[model samples]
Target: MPAICKLARQRLHWLGLSVCLLTLAPEAAHSQDMREVRRTVRYLTSRHLHGRGYTHHGDQRAAAFLARQFKSLGLVPFKSAAAYTQPFPLTVNTFPGRLAVTVDGHKLQPGQDFILAPESAGGRFTASVVYFDSLALGQEGARQQFLAQPLQAVALVLTQPDYQRIQAQPLLAQKLGEARALVILVPGKLTASLAPRQVAQPKLLVAAPAWPHAARQITLVLDACLQENYRTQNVLGYIPGTARLDSLLVVTAHYDHLGELGRHHFFPGANDNASGTSMLLQLARHLSQPSHRLRYTVVFIGFSGEEAGLLGSRYFTAHPLFPLDKVRFLLNLDLVGTGDTGATVVNGTLHPKEYQLLQQLNTGPASVGPLSARGRAANSDHFPFSEAGVPAFFLYTRGGIAAYHDVDDRAETLPLTRYNELFQLLSQFLTHLAH
Candidate 1:
C-alpha cells in the first residue's frame, strides 16, 4: 500500500506544470526538502522530548529547541523581546509515575493495553469487580443498588458505549464517584489527552479485547499529579518583509502533545502536531532565505499549551505584542502528516476570497486531493485569532494512519504521503500573497 501511494504521488507530481513556469518567484523552483522535515519529525518524536507534554519539562525543552532553530534560521524575535521566547503559565493534570493494571491475575502493559483517564486521580488498590450494562443502569432499583456499592472495595466495569451514556448524565456520572475506581473497556485505539484539573475518582481505560470477559477482581496503581502555574513558553520569530514591513502574515502550529504517561511510556504524537511543527519550521527556513522573502513580515509561532486547551494561543491573542490589526492573514497547521485522501480548511466559508485563492493555487492533478471548505471551527490555534477579527484558516491533511493521541502515532509509521505536494502548494500561495 505504501508503494502504491508513492507511485500515485509521483504520477501526480509529473502531471502539473511547475509554478515557476508561471512566472512565480525563484524559490518555487526548489525541489521538495523532505530530508529536513523527516529529521525534524524524528527528533520531535524521540523519547527524550517526553512527548512534548506538561511533565518532565517536555514543553519547555521543545520551546528551547525551536528557539535555537529560529536563531539558526536567522529569524528575529518579536519586537522588543529579549529572545524568541514568550513565557506563560499553565495548570494541568499529569501522570508521571507508576501506571499498572492487573485483571484476573494477568498483568497488562501501560499505553499498549490500557491508558488512564486524563483527569483520573492516583490510587493503589485491589477491588472486587461489578460489571454493569447500560440497560441495568436504566432501572431505578439497579441504579440504586450499584450506587450503594462500598467505596474503596468495588470497581465498576462498563463498555465504552455504556461509559459514554453514563457520562452524558451528570447525576449518574457524579454518583459514580462512590465507587473505588471506574474501568472503561474501549474496543478501539487507546487515546490519551490532557486535563485542566484532576478528578477525585480514579479511572482506567482498558482495551476491550485485553480485558478478561469474566474477570472478577482487578488491581491498579496509578500515580498522578496536578501541577499549578507550570511555566512554559511559546517560540516566536519572523522574517522582515522587503516592502510592507508593518503588515504581517502569520503561520502557527502547536508544539505540545499528551506528554509522558509514566516514567517509561510516552505518546510520540508524530501526526498530531509534530508533523505540523516540522512543516512550520520548514516554512521558517524557506521564508528566511533571501530569495523567498515576501512584501510583508512573515511570523512563525510554535505555540505550547495547545493540548492543554489552546492556552498558549489564547494568551497571545489577549496580550498580543504587536497590534492585531496589522495581521493580514493567519494560517494554523495541525495533523498534516498524511494526505492520502484530501484536506480541510476550517473557517474557509467565512472568507471565500482566501479560500478561492487556495483553490486557484490548488489546481492541476499535482494537488493532493479534494480541498474541502469548512465553516468556523474552534478546533485549533486559529480560533483565538479569528475571534479577534484576524483572518485565519486552520488546515489539516486527512487519510493515512489511524494512529492519533495514542502510543502508536510514531515517526516510524508516519507516511508523509502528500508532504511535498502540500509544501509546493503553500509556496505558490505565499508567492501570490506577495502580489
Candidate 2:
C-alpha cells in the first residue's frame, strides 16, 4: 500500500472506515461530494428559501440549516458564541408584495420588464408619463419648472443618464422625489441590490425595449417596507488542530443573497454566493475527516448580510469569537461557479509570496488558469478580515454566465465548470499551510 493510503487508513481505523476509504481512489472520494455540493446550491436557491434574502425569513432559515450542518460535521461552536450563531441586527428595505406595473395598458413581467430601485418606496399611481432626456433636464431652470407643476399628475420618465445626473444633484433628486414616481429607462439588464432605507417616492427601472415609444400613461403598484432591526446571524464553527491549535486558518463565504424581488421575482444567486458557500462547506467536510486533520485550527464561517454590504463579516471582526491576531491566514470565496478561462485572487498583488505559493500548488487538470492576480478590493467578505490585519485572499472563478444580481442567477443556470479543480486547489493549499 502507498504511504499516504496507509497513513489515512491508520488514522481512520479508529472510526472503522478504513476499508471504505481504501476502496475508493482520492479523486473518486472527492468527486462523490460534488453531488452534495450541487444539492446544497439547489436547496439554498430553492423557492422555499425565498432567494435566501430578508423576505419570508429566508436568511434565518438558511442560518438554521447551516447550524445543523456544522453540528453534523462535529464542528464545535465557540465557547463565547450563541450556539454556533453570531446574531446581529440590520435595517433593510424589502418588497414583500403587491408588485404590478403597466405601461400603456401592457402588463409587463416583474423581472423581465422592470425592477424597482433597491430603495424604492411603496406607492400606487396611475398617471400621465412625461419623458425627459439629458438635454431636456440639463438646465437647472427646466428642472425647477418641472418640479413646480402638480407632481401628482405625472410620472416622470427620464433617460438613464438624466436619472443618474439628477441623483447626483441632490437638490433636483429631492425635488423630483415629490413626483408621483420616477421611471428610469435602462438600456440593458436590470440588476438589483439591498438597501438599508427607502426613498420618498418609488423609482422604477424599465427596460428600454419594454417601454412603448408613445406610451401615454403608467401604473405602478408596489409594496415596500423599511424593516428596521431585522435580526440575522453569521454561522460559524471550527475544528481544533492536533498541533498549533493557537494559530488558525479561516475560510469564509456569504450565504445571504438578493432574496425575492417581490412575491414572485427572486434572485437565485447560485454563482454570486451559493457556489462559494458550497465550497466552504465542502472544505469543512474534508478537513473534519480524521485522516485530513491539520496542524492549525480551521475555522469555517458562512456569513450573512454580505449583500447588505458585508455587515456580518464586519461585525465578526469587531466582535470576534477568537483573537483576530491569531488568524494566520484567511481565504474568502465568492462567485466561483465557473472556471473556463481561470480565476483571480483579489489582494494577490499585495501578498506576492503567498500568491506564488498558490500558483505553484495548482497544477494538472485541476489548475485554474491563466491564474491571475489583483490588488486590494472591498468587494467580498475578505475585506473586513484584511482590514483587521489578517492575511487574506478573495478567490473567484472567471469566464462563465454573466447572470448576477438578477432573477436569472438560478442554480439551474450555474455552470460550476471547474468546481472539482477549485476544490482540489483549496485542499492542496490548506495542506501546505500546515507546514
Candidate 3:
C-alpha cells in the first residue's frame, strides 16, 4: 500500500511538470519566432523594392509580391475579386522638363537646391525678392501692406502658420494682383523636411515657358513643367471567414515612398511603411485557416499614393469592392519594426476600451513596454475608415529611428528588437476582438 501511494505521488509530480513546460513552451517559441518578423522586414525593405513608387514599377512589383504571399497563406479571394487584386486609379504629377532656379545669378538644380511647385505658371522676369512677414487672412493691416507694395519682381514670401488658411481663401491672391512671379519660401520652421511632391495642392498653374510676366527685366524664371500623366496603384488581398461573412476586420499599410530626386537620393521608407506592409502579410498568414472560426472576415490592403494625401485609401472608400458598412474595424499598421522603447496607438483616445484591452494584453510575458496613446489624427490610411465612421486604429513604433522621409531610412538600419512582442500582442488582440 505504501509503495502504491508513493508511485501515485510520483505520477502527479510528473504531470505537474509537463503542464508547466507546456505553458512555458509557447513563450519560448514566440521569442524565437520573432526572427521571422525581422526576416520579413528585411526582405520587404530591400533595395530591390526601390522605394515602391509608381514611376519605377516598384509599387507594382510590391503588390505582386504581397499577392503571392497571400495566396501562399491560403487566404481566399473576396467575393468577385479575381485573385485578390483591387485596382484603383490615380493621377501623379512629375517633372519632365528642366527645372532650374537662379537666385542672385546662382543656378539651382531641381530638388537639390529648389523644388518647383507643380502648379506654378512657367515664365521669366526680373523682380526684387519681396518678403512678406506673416500672411494671415484676418490681419487686414498685413494684407494691405502686402497689396500696397509695387508687386513687380518675384515675391519671395516666407511661409507662416496662417499661410495655408489665408491661401485657402482665394480672395487674398486676387487682392495682391499679378506680380512678375511668386517665389514662396517655405519658412525655416516648416522647411525641416522635404514635402512630398504628389500630395501638395494645385495652387500653382502649369505652363510651358515663353517668359510671360507682368513685369520686365527681372528674369523670374518659372522653369517647371508637369508630366500630367503618372501612374500609381493600391494593392488588395483578403482572407474569408467562416461564421461572420458580413463583417470584416481590415488590415492596411501604405507601401509607397518618395522616389528618387537626384544622384545619391531615395527615401527607402523601410520603417515608414515596408515594416507595416510586412506585418500585414504576417497577419494574413497567421490567420489563414478556415477552421480558425473568425467572427469577421479579414482584408489585407497595401495602399499606394499614401504619400499623396491618403489617395489610395480615399479611392478605396469611394469605390469599395466590399461593402464599407460591413467593415467592423480597421487596424492600419504604419511603422512597427523598431519599438525597442515602445509604440504609439493613434485613435486610442477615441476607442479607450479597445486601447485598454491591447494595453492589458501587452503586459504579459511578451511585454514590449511604455506604450503611448494619441488622439485621432488623419495622418495615415486609417483616416478614411475613421471618417467613414468605421472603428479604426493606427499603430506605429514610437522611437529608435527618426530618419523618416529621408534616404537614411533603410532596412538594414532598422531596429526590430521589439517586433516579436508587437506581433504577439497584435495576434492576441485580434483573437480577443474576433471573439
Best by lDDT: 2
lDDT of 2 at 288: 85
Winner of 1 and 2 under TM-score? 2
Q: In candidate 3, residue 37 scores what lDDT?
A: 53
Cα lDDT tens digits for candidate 1, 1-435: 467446534433432222123224444433445655776787778777789988877887678778877876778897755589888899999998888888899998888889989899999899899886566468988777766656556898888888888887787787777788988899888888888898887888899998987999988888999989998888898899999989998999999999987789999999989999988987877777777789999989999999889999999999887888999889899999999988899999999998899998887878968899999988999999999999999999989999989999999999998887787787677767767
lDDT values of the candidates? 0.84, 0.85, 0.64
RMSD of 3: 13.6
Question: Compared with the true structure, what per-residue lDDT tens digits does model 3 show for residues 220-279?
Answer: 444333333355567676776667877888889988765543223345777888889878
Which 10-residue span in candidate 3 carries the lowest summed lDDT? 200-209
Error of 1 at 102 (Å): 1.3
Ranking by lDDT: 2, 1, 3
Residue 311 alpha-carbon offset, candidate 2, angstroms: 0.4
TM-scores across all candidates?
0.91, 0.92, 0.69
Higher-lDDT candidate among 1 and 3? 1
- Give the higher-lDDT candidate: 2 or 3: 2
Q: After superposition, which runs of candidate 2 have C-alpha atoms over 4 Å from their true positions?
A: 1-31, 139-144
